[model samples]
Target: MAPSLREGVSQARSFEFLRLGRQAPWLVLGLGLLLGPGAFPHRARAAPASGADPAALLEQGREAYEMLECPKAVASFRKVLAHPKATPAQRVEAYVGQAWCQVVEGNEALARETLQKALEIRPDYPVSPDLSPKLAAVLEAAQRDFRARAKVEIDLDVTARGAPPELGMRVRDPAGQVNEVLVRYRTDGEWREVAAHSEGASLWTARLEGAAAGTLPLYVETKNRYGFVSGREGTAESPVAVRVEPAAVSAALAPPAATGAASGTALTPLAWTAAGLAVATVGAGTFFGLKAKEEEARFNGDPSQFGSHDEALAVGRSAQRNATTATVLFVSAGVLAATSGLLFVVDGSHGPAGDAVEPGFAAAAMPLHGGGLFALAGRF
Candidate 1:
């Protein structure tokens, strides 16, 4: 027969309880806590909470400051700054809040230091009216300190001559951290960059070789040692407009022939020299021709007036020789004169000088061996 109910209960209680009975509840609780809500049973997890939002922290900090809880405000602001997700504006706001907290606690030195951090983030950030007058004073002093540390000034000089455009810059960087300056420019095409060479402390120059003559859009960028842009005169989007002279452009585009003509010195001198030579030859020819004519006239006037036939023959021969000599000189003069005139025409046609003076020509015919000689002279 089955044991009676009281006896059975007592006996069952005496049998040791299953090990799970005491530990299972605690085990489940431990698992639930470790896995967190909605976590898979097989994939245990830590707590589900994420990092505090930077924007929320910033707001909370502002509220804490308004309530005059300087320590809590500073704690919230510091958390916002330490968060990686914080934006530049949020960072600046946090620094300002923390600085104001320091000022309220009578920690003026620390307050100025904190304000300096905010100014480094944004030098132009206005002092908030919520800040105490003392804090505002600290902020101003912090700004002055930041400016002293990071001030950058750029002075640019652009010179466009007939060749290429040259750019010079004087950078007043009190921090002495600027390592280089770059000249950014463009003509009709895309923007280009040329590295500037340092001439001395704060002085730099760059020559843009292929920059054409037109409206050159340009800007100067100063860089630090690691190539971080430290300063800018103008941005690439809104560059400084510089007008390049058209005269220089024209000269650059001119052809070699055009270049020679512009000077116009080469052929003009040669033409003049040829003309002078021709004049001398012609004068000599004329003198010989006159002597020949005079001798011939005397010989023809009286044959019997000669002492003998041989004497008359000699006189005639002498006249003929003179005539021949005159003819040869005349021919040479004519050739030289023609060459001079041709040279002058060539020079005037090609030269930058528009007009040339017309050369004069003279010709004389001889008795028998007669070819007229001509000489020409002209100003080129």
Candidate 2:
């Protein structure tokens, strides 16, 4: 090999070793962790106070875990961390609890990192004896794996369902183009990658999208300029399970039910009102129409009866009022009738053959505040 190439190879190996050196402490810790619970050489921190007990939260997380509600369990563990006066031991408990959940949720890398954090808080921390052997193994592997890589801080989104499943994940993203965050999702037995862009300081996000309202599995990773990848990886410890469900319609935002009938014959209130308005307007039109015709006859009966120009003008004015009133009522009747007809047709289409609304009687005389005759009967 040329001296220059040899020198380049040497430099590459040196960089690799240097990188491995930085990870050495975590590796040693991971090996010790492999010894299993009650074996670490650190003192036990006292449990939290009764008033600030984290045990309940731990139990809550545990129950969620057993039920395969990893997201809920993660939440409980987070609450433990947020507890007002959680002790170091309690904090460790929370960390471990979350790690356990992360493993089951297919975020094995995250689980590993969490366990490492717990170990930092208490090097001698032991696994809970109450944990099942299967879970113990998961925890064991996660801790062992953490030694292999450094982890970035992350927050996972676990919404049950919302518009496109409110994909909100917060993770530490270095502020540079050289490092890129990528989210990979597994669907239909295929893995696809999507770029996760920076949202804020150290926050990278990729909105999760689902197809056909189903479950999706996805994980986040970051690649540096050096081609080194670090981030959460799915393992038995963290099998990402996200359910994509149809978006719920809030009562406030729900679309109105069709005025049309499910069986094809139901009429909306508007449709019914339109029909009544058409009938009422038609009735008015008929009455006015007759009055107009009557006035016309009276005028033709004796044009000479008007003795002066003023008298003729007076008769003409009366005829004009009659004509105008009749014209308005007739126009209104045509419009309302058309509207009602359209409504009725639409309502009928929504109903099944047997569900069509039976003919209803026309508005029986509307009762006025004071006794009055709206209409005794229709002539036409």
Candidate 3:
């Protein structure tokens, strides 16, 4: 018949002892020579401090287990578990190590209990197949029991419904430990937070209004009374998305606008009058200038034909008066044209219709029959 698990472990230890015992004679003589007869039985050293490195403690515990020191291994593992700054992974590993020691000591019940605590920290903790058959069987039993335990978690159900299109979220906190629930949502580019109100038994609701049509990313978090988050459905880094549809309207809406075309503005009457006056003065100035030239030409052509010196003087004075009249008319035309151009420019702001003409004047003198004729022109 095959040996039991404990019997097999005991037999293996016996074989290791026999192998070491072969060199014990020389080892004992050497130790006696180094420390007199008083060192026949050595005293055990003090345990490591609780504040020691958890990883170091865990390694020490594993080495003790390999040397068949179950009690010392258990103590080292407990120190790792008791460390204040021990990580979850480290604590879980320590618990597993203690459970292995308990299994080797023939305490299967205590080993199973220890394994359950490790599973509480990490339910997916693997049961290594390389473990001894007795320890593997104990680990499998603990995993089965852990799965059969009751579940306590928060649940969130989201729906986009209702008139005017409000987003509704239904939350359930079965553990009854959640003090408050909130939803963080984003419509365009900014994220917003809203508190949820209790609606019914194990049911809470949050309504979000005025969301545009698109994919909205959101997350739900349940907090304790102290404002620390206890449970969460989604996170800010990885948010859940829901579709928002556009609202529909009836076909029979309001009528078209009453005024469609933009009102236009024309040049004022005052501006038109100034322009007309400018043109009339230019025509009058040209006529007077031609008359001045004709008078001078006739007077110079025949001095005796004038019939008398007085007539000739009268003709010369008449030519001088015509020339002065032409000069005055041309000056008046330039002033009138400038006024017209200024008015046009001011009125141009009312509309964009005609080209802008700059107001300017040019004068030239030509010698005709030993007499000068002045000509002036203006643009408006």
User: Residue 58: error of model 1 in Å?
Assistant: 1.2
Error of 1 at 210 (Å): 14
lDDT of 1 by residue, 1-380 (tens): 98999999987886646655887668755643432222111223234324589867876776566556678878988998999989877887798778767766778789788877766555556755544455557877887777778877877654343456665567888865477788888855788899988899777878776777767789988776544566788888899765554555534433323233353547888999999999999999999999999999989996778999899999999999999999999999999999999987787655356544343333222111123323333232
Best by lDDT: 1
Query: What overall lDDT goes with each candidate model?
Result: 0.70, 0.61, 0.67
Residue runs of model 3 more than 4 Å from their true location after superposition: 1-51, 123-137, 153-380
Model 2 stretches astray by more than 4 angstroms: 1-150, 160-163, 173-178, 233-238, 249-380
Q: Roughly what TM-score does model 2 have, to 2 decimal places?
A: 0.25
Name the candidate, 1 or 3, with the larger lDDT value: 1
For all predicted structures, in order, the TM-scores are: 0.38, 0.25, 0.35
Alpha-carbon shift of residue 342 in model 1 (angstroms): 43
Q: How do the residues 1-380 of candidate 3 rate in per-residue lDDT, one tens digit apiece?
A: 99999999999999999988997767755633432222111224436434479877876776576565779988989999999978887888799888877766778899889998877666556656455556668888998786566222545443343333455444544434467888888866788888887877766767666566667788888775545464576778999776554553211111222233331235556677877887898888888888889889988886768888898888888888988998898898888778877776676444234434344445433222234545554432
